[model samples]
Target: GGVALVIDGKALGHVLEQGMHHAIVRLGSVCSSVVCCRSTPVQKQQVVKTMKEALPIRTLAIGDGANDVAMIQEAHVGFGVMGNEGMQAVMSSDFVIGQFRFLKRALLLHGRWNYLRTGL
Candidate 1:
C-alpha cells in the first residue's frame, strides 16, 4: 500500500535537496502521489524538472493559470486548460483544451493513436 503526501512549499525545498534518484526512490516507496500545496512557481517547475530528469517515463503537467506557466513549460508534455484563469498557460503549453474533462480524450485517444503512429 502507498500513501498520499501533502507537502507545502517549505517542505519541497528540503525534498529537492536530496539526490534525484534517492528522492524518487524514497518517495515512491511510501507515496503514490505527492501534492505540493502553496508552492511557488519555481517550486512547481522544480518538481516537473526533477521528475523529467530522474525518471525515464514521460512527465505531463496540467494547469490553467499564469502561476502554472513555469511548471507547464518545464514538463515533457504540458496540458493547458482554457478557463477564466487566463491564457498564459495556454500559450506555453504543448496542448490546449477547452475544458478539463477533454483531457481524457486527449490523453487516452489522441495520445495513444499518435504514439502508435509514431512508434515512440
Candidate 2:
C-alpha cells in the first residue's frame, strides 16, 4: 500500500540507468545493472537467468502481480505483496507481505534474526 510512482517505461529506464551509473562510480564497480522494458513473463525469466549466469550469487525477485509469477518462481527468494490486488502473486510467493514496509524490515533485520535462530 505504500508503493508510489508509476512512470512511463522510457523515463523509468533512463532513471534506472542513471542510478546504476552513479552506483558504479560511487562504489568503484558495478553493484547492479538495469534492464529496461521487459514486457513479458518469459522475458523476465530470461533476464533473471541471464543475471544468475553472469553472477555467482543468489538472486531475489519481489513483485505484486500475475505478470511477475514466473520471475518470482525463478529466484532464490521470492516475495509477494498481499492484502492488495495481488492474489495470484501472493499464492505463488515464498513470503507474502500483508504490510508492505514490513517487507524491508523482514529482509533486513527479522529475516536475519530468523536465520540465526534457526542456524541456517
Which number leads on TM-score? Answer: 1
Least accurate 10 contiguous residues by lDDT in model 1: 20-29
What is the lDDT for 19 in model 2?
53
Candidate 2, residue 17: how far the Cα is off, in Å: 19
Model 1 reaches what TM-score against the true structure? 0.78
Q: Give candidate 1 misplaced runs (Cα > 4 Å).
A: 1-6, 17-21, 28-34
Q: Write candidate 2's Cα lDDT for 30-82 as tens digits.
A: 44433325446665565555556656667777777898889889888888887
Q: What is the lDDT of candidate 2?
A: 0.64
- The TM-score of predicted model 2 comes to 0.65
The clash count of every prediction, one per candidate, is: 0, 0
| Model 2 stretches with alpha carbons more than 4 Å out | 1-29, 32-38
TM-score per candidate: 0.78, 0.65
- RMSD for each of the candidates: 3.1, 6.8
